[model samples]
Target chain A: MTRLITILIATTLLAACSTQPTEPDTTLYNRLGGQAGITTIVDNLLFEIGGNETLIGFFADTDIDRFREKLIEQLCEVSDGPCEYTGDSMAQVHADMDIDNRHFDALVTDLITAMTEAGVPTGAQNDLLARLVPMHDEVIHAEEHLNGDER
Target chain B: MPDRKTRLVTLMLTGLLAGPAFGASKILATSGAGSIEGAAGGGLVPWAVIGGYGSDGEWGAAASLGRVDVDDFRLGTASVLAGVHDRLEVSFAQQTLQVEPLDAVIEQHVYGVKTRVAGHLIYGRLPQLSFGLQHKVNQNPAIATDVLGANSASGTDTYIAASKLYLHALFERDLLLNGTLRYTDANQTGLLGFGNSGGEDPQLVGEASVGLFLNPNWAIGAEYRQKPDRLDAVDEDAWRDVFVAWFPNKRVSVVGAYADLGSIALWDDQQGWYLSVQITN
Candidate 1:
């Protein structure tokens, strides 16, 4: 029994060890091709979103050029790139959009399609998606959270 | 390690996966495989994920056929599942079990309802949690009640399942962990009927599964199910399976596994292959 327990512990430690990043040269931003690559990805995302009727409505009143710039900055900041996001907070920007999980799913689908079209590898795509997943709560329940803050 | 026969099977599976399109918004394989009991989960254990591709405010359904063949037994099942608003799931399955020695066939029907009570499969602080109940009835109960001295021909099993996904956790691949706590006394999952002949109480058991995503389209996993030891006439061992699943599109998924049922009734070393295909919309 003791030996079994020891083997189990060793396997767990090995699993934990593999999660650590081993590559010093390749940051997530570098894998996405840095500035030029990021621009292409964002552009591809905007094009796909434009064609998606369900998600396109959310951007109806927004200024396209500024939205593009802010999104690029946001992606860069999230990927640990060399840019700082100067736009409004995620919750604040999406506060009145009335977005729900369905819309969120559609948007995520479009983003993945865009990244795939931009030639991002599967590993890099997964890494970026994982980092952005935390913002889901902010995107969907922005009004409720903002109301809570006000209260 | 791609052999010619395996490559042929893979190509055939790829061909079978191409069908008409139906849309569901969730990411690929976020909804787990169709369990034997008709719930969304691994091949043997139920998971917290709701079946189908629907997100909030959306509804979807799935239909599946599964078969398992061991040295001495054969089991076949057909199941259908419905998911409402990404929160509630209702399912039904009919299973047939064939025992080689006795040349006896037992048919059973299962009805299940599962609801996700908290958290999300992805993007949440808490692991995805769900509560579910499965009611089973044996169509051919004469052998169990008359021969095995079982408590009843019908029984209900309740469970709480939790699941979580860790991104880039193992070898730069995503890892999924799930645990299910179940309450039941059904012997051989109700194939031999419910409870022991001497009226032993239902026991709490554990079921768990782990999966590593090789890519967005493919995953490899293993599952273990702990069983009750109530039947004095027969010894029932635990169940285990290692599986590979392919999601060619939102419409279809295929799962193949090597299952070890341990021992069933009088037969020992009950190991076999299991395969299932599901279509969703």
Candidate 2:
């Protein structure tokens, strides 16, 4: 009876663990189609955002080529690729930009559109978006001015 | 002539149409259509996602109508939900179950509240987690007690759900996964009533959904919901469904599914179609 109970408990524990979703062994960078794919996606995303009137104002004074390179590097580093991002920290880059949730969401939309057009798998696109989502706190600074006097 | 329910639904539809179109802030398809219980989720399972496009300090509301027709039974539900600050959601739902041949009608009033406890579905390493409670009351206690052998006319279900959107899981598609643990004594989702004459305890059950986004607006998924077997009169089996959902725009969504409800009220193999339409602001 004791031996039978031990087997039953082991089987139940294994079944429970098997029900949970497991992460894949492959890194996100490789899943995102590597360097060339990332470049194409970033280019397409920037192009789409550049054409949008609502977003073009944010990039008007920025250097297109340098910005593109920095974005590619940032994405590569974030995805665990063989590249280093030399760009400024997210907080430092957007400190005084007055970026809000609206602009951040718009950029994310453009990025998703670009990834979709470039045939980046939906899973990879979402994975990348998940990593970038936490940056919203560092990037959005509209409330700072609203409570300026209090601080 | 349209009945009072029809007129009320029409008025709500008109209001939804006239509501201002807010800019879509949340990711498309992130705020899923209202579930049968009036919470933001899939057809039957309530996901951890908060409803609407509302984020912090914002408010949003949604209305939905759903119909599930099986071999022996038919269920119709209408619900409205409001979300505050993307953290708390409160909702109301009315369900009507129609039994064929016997032509018995069971009605239920459900009031639900869910709060996002932690994490972000798309942005964080931790999966989105939420706590939800649904208080359900059967309109006719005599019918419930006599036909279903229920001990009470009302019950409350409490659930904890965790949801995660896995970017690029299969063939480059985004996958949305959710798991829920619920404690309840409700029979037939509370349409029949709570507990039974068997002196059964409130059972803990599991529900899960796995969805693959074909695009930003479309998703295909499957769900499994475990149920309790309390009444000795008839056996209740688990419920499962394969579904497709379409988001035509930010304000409107439609879902169609094939569901297997198993034995319901002595009828077996209760499998058929499920359809729902939702409008949000």
Q: Quick one: best DockQ, which candidate?
A: 1
For candidate 2, the docking band is incorrect
Give the Å shift of residue A47 in candidate 2. Answer: 7.6
Candidates' RMSD to native: 5.9, 7.4
Candidate 1, B1-281: lDDT as tens digits: 33343354344334434533244777788878878888988888999999988888778677777889888998877787888888999998878888988998988889999999998888778999999999999999888888887889999999999999887677777889999999997998999899876774699999999987766778877788999977777789989877788988787888998888878888888888899888786
With a 3 Å backbone cut-off (N, CA, C), the pairs that clash in candidate 2 are A121-B172, A122-B172, A123-B167, A123-B168, A123-B173, A123-B174, A124-B167, A124-B168, A127-B167
Q: Which whole-number lDDT from 0 to 100 does residue A49 have in model 2?
A: 94
Q: What TM-score, computed on C-alpha atoms, does each candidate reach?
A: 0.89, 0.79
Worst 10 residues of 2 chain A by lDDT: A1-10
Q: Which ten contiguous residues of candidate 1 chain A have the minimum total lDDT?
A: A1-10
Compared with the true structure, all predictions reach lDDT values of 0.83, 0.80
Judge candidate 1 at residue B224 and give its lDDT. Answer: 87
The runs of at least 3 residues in candidate 2 whose Cα sits more than 4 Å from the true structure, single-residue gaps closed, are A1-85, A96-104, A114-151, B1-3, B198-200
DockQ, candidate no. 1:
0.42
Give the native contact fraction of candidate 2.
Answer: 0.37
